[model samples]
Target: HREAHAMQKDWMRQSGIEEEEKAPSIDNFEKIAAERVHLGLLVNELVLSRELKLDDEKVKTKLAEVTNAYPNGDEIRKMYEQNSELMDQLKSTVMEDQVVEWLTERSSFNEKEIEFKELINNNQ
Candidate 1:
């Protein structure tokens, strides 16, 4: 579906309808991949060190949050519920969020709003 969306957008762009997208470079992709790996390691370490556990309800909640955007959301959700691989992936993602929340709760940081440009610049 993502590939299909991109193909549609590309055709629109060629037709002079859609605006050019600002996708980052492969170098940025590598950086982001590394950062994700580091985060996954940190989450795992904390999970083991703090003895944190995943809640089944969180996975269900995450699934609902994920599927609610689609047209046939309820149907997709039901299908996902019956798929072991998708359920396992969702469970892992929920655990990652739970671990991040645990870290955030114990840490101190100032909250400030920034522009979209600034956010993208910072990421780059």
Candidate 2:
């Protein structure tokens, strides 16, 4: 932050905007944080309400499938170490998908395959 401020000061001096007053504060940091927490809780509840279960065996199998993409064992281990928390998050996501799959498996949910180009065009 100190370096960023220093660089900003230099830029301001160069641009002859040093005398300009600081921008007004929105002062909604807490509100934004609360909203983010609320969104996270909402998503988690959605996953949980679906009764998603992620067993250790499933996690291992998924990991094995993922590791297949990384030919180097050390690279895979390094990636896992660097993103252990992300791994847990992915596991949770897998559990949620399992719930979705389970529901769709029991009850038929009519799904149609659209061409990739058509789907993108429609989204845009």
Candidate 3:
């Protein structure tokens, strides 16, 4: 990041664009923040449209996968012991996913399949 900033400074010097001492007073900060929130909501909507779920079985499977990485790893057990609240939150997340999946099956959404490369390029 420092290197990028230094390069930017050099570029500014060459181009004769002075760096401002302070940020501009953008009157529409609230509007910009709202747009970012809306974009996040839209991205979640896209994921929900795919009928994804994170149910109890899914959570267990994920935990098992992680534990498999270290044969004698007690990280999962330690996490469960230390983070009871996190466990409950994970349970709620799983329940919410199940509900969303149920709703998605009944809801109407446009279906379009695009290549992963094309999707990445489009996002960029």
Model 3 CA deviation exceeding 4 Å by range: 1-55, 65-73, 111-124
lDDT of 3 by residue, 13-83 (tens): 67776853432323324455566457547646755786555566776755566556786658765675478
Worst 10 residues of 2 by lDDT: 20-29
Q: By TM-score, who's the top model here? A: 1
* Better-scoring candidate (lDDT), 1 or 2: 1
The positional error of residue 55 in candidate 3, measured at the CA in angstroms, is 5.4
Query: 8 in model 1: Cα distance from truth in Å?
Result: 18
Tally clashing residue pairs in candidate 1.
Answer: 0
Error of 2 at 34 (Å): 15
Q: What is the C-alpha lDDT of each candidate?
A: 0.78, 0.64, 0.60
Clashes per candidate, residues 3 or more apart or on different chains: 0, 0, 0
Pairs clashing within candidate 1: none
TM-score of model 2 vs. true structure: 0.44
Return whichever of 2 and 3 wins on lDDT.
2
Could you give the candidate ranking by TM-score, starting with the highest? 1, 2, 3
What is the TM-score (0 to 1) of candidate 1? 0.60
Q: How does candidate 2 score on lDDT? A: 0.64
